[model samples]
Target: MDMKLEVVILPVSDVDRAKDFYAGRLGWRLDADFPIEDGYRIVQVTPPGSACSVIFGEGLTGQQAGTLHGLQLTVTDIVKAQEELASCGVEVSGPFRDETGAFHHAGDARRVPGAHPERASYGTFAAFEDPDGNAWFLQEVTERAPGR
Candidate 1:
């Protein structure tokens, strides 16, 4: 059996605000947005060149508005991604490097304590949160130098 992860569901209070944040601020492509019934809406978005997409809508199963947590999105360059998000008025947390390489946050300026350096073999990583308090991470990794 071949199985693949396809979509992730995010909970939000307002669909329009979430749409603007993911699409307008973060630059995620709007995949779908429409109403299903009784004024409920369904919205989906995909990050640039990503296989999995995020889904948010009214009345999702076992998901409460503004109750989601710890959804990480990886990026190629942490610094560049942080800069871009900062330019869009999103608060970026850190670029701190210790024995465990470097890590940061996207929204708040705080280093996630106890992050080991060996965990970061690539470049570095950071985190941020959307307007709805949805947390995300921007990871940077060094390209493997040819063949070791």
Candidate 2:
């Protein structure tokens, strides 16, 4: 069977604020905003050119707000992606190369200044967060592995 990942449900403290940050600041396409019973609401947003989307809603999750970590987005150009996210008021960090020359972890210990010297795919990244501090990483993957 083929299984495709579709959505991630982020836990947020305030629905409207989180919605604004994802849909407005990050410029994700607003897919839906539906109000259900008992004052609950569901909001869905999709990143540009992505098949997957993220969602958040009242009463939808037990996860704490700001606890989601290390979600990643891939792009062809790290610098351009960082510039665009920063321009959108997203507070994106400068692209960095991990000290281990591999994927980065959740803290600053793994980060060093500037993009990878050769701009190797999956080697350079920048980071940002949503309003409730759900961290997201932008990774540069200029060339995919064979058959990807």
Candidate 3:
């Protein structure tokens, strides 16, 4: 048996605003915008080179908008990715990493400026949020761990 992740449904306050942020600002591919009725709708978009998609709109999930966090996206170049997002008007923060010389540490850990030592894959990170404050992280992964 196999289960493959396909989409994430995000609760958003304004459907058009969320749609604009994801599809217009982030440059994600707008897969659909279907209004099933006067009060229900579905909007879907997929990030570049990502198999998973994001869905948001009216009458969807009951969770509060902007409540989601810690969602991560893997990229080959952290700086380049941040630059792209910044250019798109997304308020991006970081290219930071835990100074522990290993995996990330707990809250308030010492995060030295810039990318990780030797630019190790999966060590460097940056963050941004959607219009609804749904946070997303960008992890620089030049090489993937075995079986990932």
**Model 2, 39-139: lDDT tens per residue?**
68899999999999999999889999999998989999988998898788878886898989998867667789999998888899988888888889889
| Tens digit of per-residue lDDT, candidate 3, span 7-31 | 9998889999998998998889999
What is the overall TM-score of model 1 with all chains considered together?
Answer: 0.76
CA lDDT of each prediction against the hidden true structure: 0.71, 0.90, 0.88
Model 2, CA-based lDDT: 0.90
Per-residue lDDT for 56-113 in model 1, tens only? 8787646766666556666666667778889988997655433324444334444444
For model 1, give the 10-residue run with minimal summed lDDT.
97-106
Top candidate on TM-score is 2
Candidate 2 vs candidate 3: which has greater lDDT?
Answer: 2
TM-score versus the correct structure, for each prediction = 0.76, 0.95, 0.92
lDDT of 2 at 78: 89
| Model 2 poorest 10 in a row by lDDT | 102-111
